[model samples]
Target: MLLSVEKITKEFPIQKGLFGTPTAYLRAVAGVSFDIEAGEVVGLVGESGCGKSTVGRCVVGLHQATDGRVLWDGKDIAKLSPEERRTLRRRFQMVFQNPFSSLNPRQKIEDVLLEPIAVHGLFRPSERAAAVQELIEQVGLSSKDLQKYPHEFSGGQRQRIGIARALACQPDLMVLDEPVSSLDVSVQASILNLLTKLNRDRKIGYLFISHDLQVVGYISTRVLVMYLGVVVEEGRVDQVLKSPRHPYTQTLLKASLGASVAVKGEQLSPAQVVPGCAFYNRCPHAESRCSNEKQDFQEVDGVWRVACWKWHKIG
Candidate 1:
């Protein structure tokens, strides 16, 4: 395995009063587990607040997980020393949802792309210029354009630059947090193409997080359906999306409109924890057990894993 996310969880304290000390907590990601093999794409899909982005952050070391393990190359990244984590940072990187905010407006593209290389000490100063040129060229930009600032490029071009900057470290795994969500449909196609080409050429693994089922279906080898920070279903993209077992998974596929579903359900609330199933209130096929006992995410007849008590009965 290239990366193993073992039951990761993250909690944030919520305040109540003006000088609130801490009234409640929000579990953004709750006990999620999965693995990404070398040169594979694993898609995480859910609604806007289903903790998809938080999982990506935990994988890339942006957020310290409140529980569980994030293992990279067989080492638990959370337990590593500061220096060790910094040194191993080059092994994985993240591409944010928006390039405009992620990239600096004051810095030129040359410096932006070169910063990672400089920090990692990947090359000698004398050999740096040619290396920068190669990276820019790989992302389909000319060296001449590197001298300009990020705001100088179009949305798609700026995204390409963002990708190039992530590639500057030559990562084995990338945490892509909705990398194409901000671009035009036509532009999204080109950026997706660039990512596909990079994966083919570099053999890099991707933890792709997106709300679009169609996008995930197109790019992912396996898919995980999340709701209220929990992975409710897991399977090959075709099996899970074509015939979702969990009610939440079924709802998400139906709402995407591109996927075929036999029953439709409503979007969920990302509120405080419920003792039972998170989808109890909105599940189209909910029963008494759904509101009383939280279902376990277990394998079903060696086909796939689901957290629904009625999974076997779902058609």
Candidate 2:
């Protein structure tokens, strides 16, 4: 596995006052687990605040998980020293959601790309300029654009530049958190295609996080559906999207694709702990046992898995 997240959980402490002891915690991610193999695109799909982005952040080491482990090539990343982690950063990178905010307006695009190469010492001083030129071209930009500021480009073009910046590190896996969510529909397709082509050519695996199912289905080979900080269903893209077993996944598909029989329920908070299934309140097929007993992940077709106790009966 290129990346493996084993039951990782992230919690933010909620303080009572300016200097008071922590009273509670907001559980953003609750024991979410997944893996990405080399050259594989694994989509993590959910609505806002479903903890999908949190999972991506944890994978890239932007956030230290409160519990469990994040393993890189079978070694726990949390155990690495700061200097070791810095050296290892070149192998993994992240692309942020908003292109407008991700880049520096004050710096030229060339300087932006050069910073990583300089920090990582990827190339000799004389070779760095040619490397930057190649990086810009790989993402479909010309050398002239490198002299321009980030504010000069459109949203889509800026996003392409962001991707080039990530590529400068020559990473093995990228954690993309809603990379195209802020772009126009036509622009979104271009960015998605660019990502697909890069993955194919470079064999760089991706953990694509998004709230859009259509985008996820288009880019990912496999999918993990999450709700309220936990995975509800996971399987091959076609298996889970075409014939979803969990109610949350079904609800998302219906809501996104205009299907009927939509599941509905009151909005719930991640901090609100449910004794049983996190989705028990919303599941139409939920039973008394669903609200009483916590459900374990049950394998369906040897590869597919669901956390709902009544998955067999629901779908």
Candidate 3:
């Protein structure tokens, strides 16, 4: 396995007053487990606040997981010391969702890319300039772009810079959090193509996090559907997208196409609540048993797993 997330859980403390005492916990990621094989792209799909980005941050060591382990190449990152973790950073990198916000507006592109290389001591000072120029060209940018600030480039160009920075250390795994969601359709297509080419040439593994099912379907070898901080379904991209076992997964597919076009007799309210099935409130086929009993993930086929009671009866 390239990466393994075993029973990971991340929670945030809620504060109610000025001198805030911890009131309740907001569970962002709950008991999520999955494995990514070498040179594979695993797409994590969910709504905005369903903790897709949070999970990505934990995988990259930005946010320490509240519970469970993030294993990279068989080493548990959470168990590593500060210095050890810093050394391990070179093997894994991240491309954030918003390119404009991720870049330093005050700094030139050269400085931004140079920082990672310098910190990791990857190259000597004399060779760093040429290396940076090479990285620019690798991402399809001109050497002239090195002198310009982020604001001087278009959204797609800024993203290329972000990709170049992430690749500076020659990482094996990249956690891309909605990398192209902020760009125009044309720009998004271009960036996606660039990423696809990079992956094929470099053999880089990716943990792609996004809410757009269509986008995920386009790039992922496998798909994992998340809801209310938990995984409800997981399978090969073709299997999951074509025949979703869990009702939540079905709703997500339908809703992606159009809100009103979802399962018949189901009108999903934004504030809908489900006591058991996180998707029970919006699921058209919800039964009394769905609301009373919690479902556990069960493997249906060799490659597909689902956490739903009515998988056989959903049709």
Best-to-worst TM-score order: 2, 1, 3
Ranking 2 against 3 by TM-score, winner:
2
Candidate 2 lDDT, tens digit per residue, 199-314?
A: 99999999999999989999999999988889889999989988999988888888888778556765488878888888888878878888878788999886699998788887
TM-scores for candidates 1 onward, in order: 0.94, 0.97, 0.93
Error of model 1, residue 74, in angstroms: 1.6
Candidate 1's error at 171, in angstroms? 0.2
Residue 163 in model 1: lDDT: 90
**Residues 1-315, candidate 1, lDDT per residue (tens digit)?**
789999999988876666877677788898999999999989999888889999999999899999999998889997899888888889889999997898899999999989999999999999988999999999999999989998898888988998999999989998899999999999999888988898888999999999998899888888988888998998888888888888777767776886665454554555576888888877778888888897797786454789987888875
**TM-score, structure 2 vs. true:** 0.97
Model 1 clash number: 0
Roughly what TM-score does model 1 have, to 2 decimal places?
0.94
lDDT by candidate, in order shown = 0.87, 0.91, 0.87
lDDT of 3 by residue, 79-134 (tens): 88888878888979999989989998999999999999999999889999999999
- Best candidate according to TM-score: 2
**Candidate 2 overall lDDT versus native:** 0.91
Off by over 4 Å in 3: 16-20, 263-275
Better of 1 and 2 by lDDT: 2
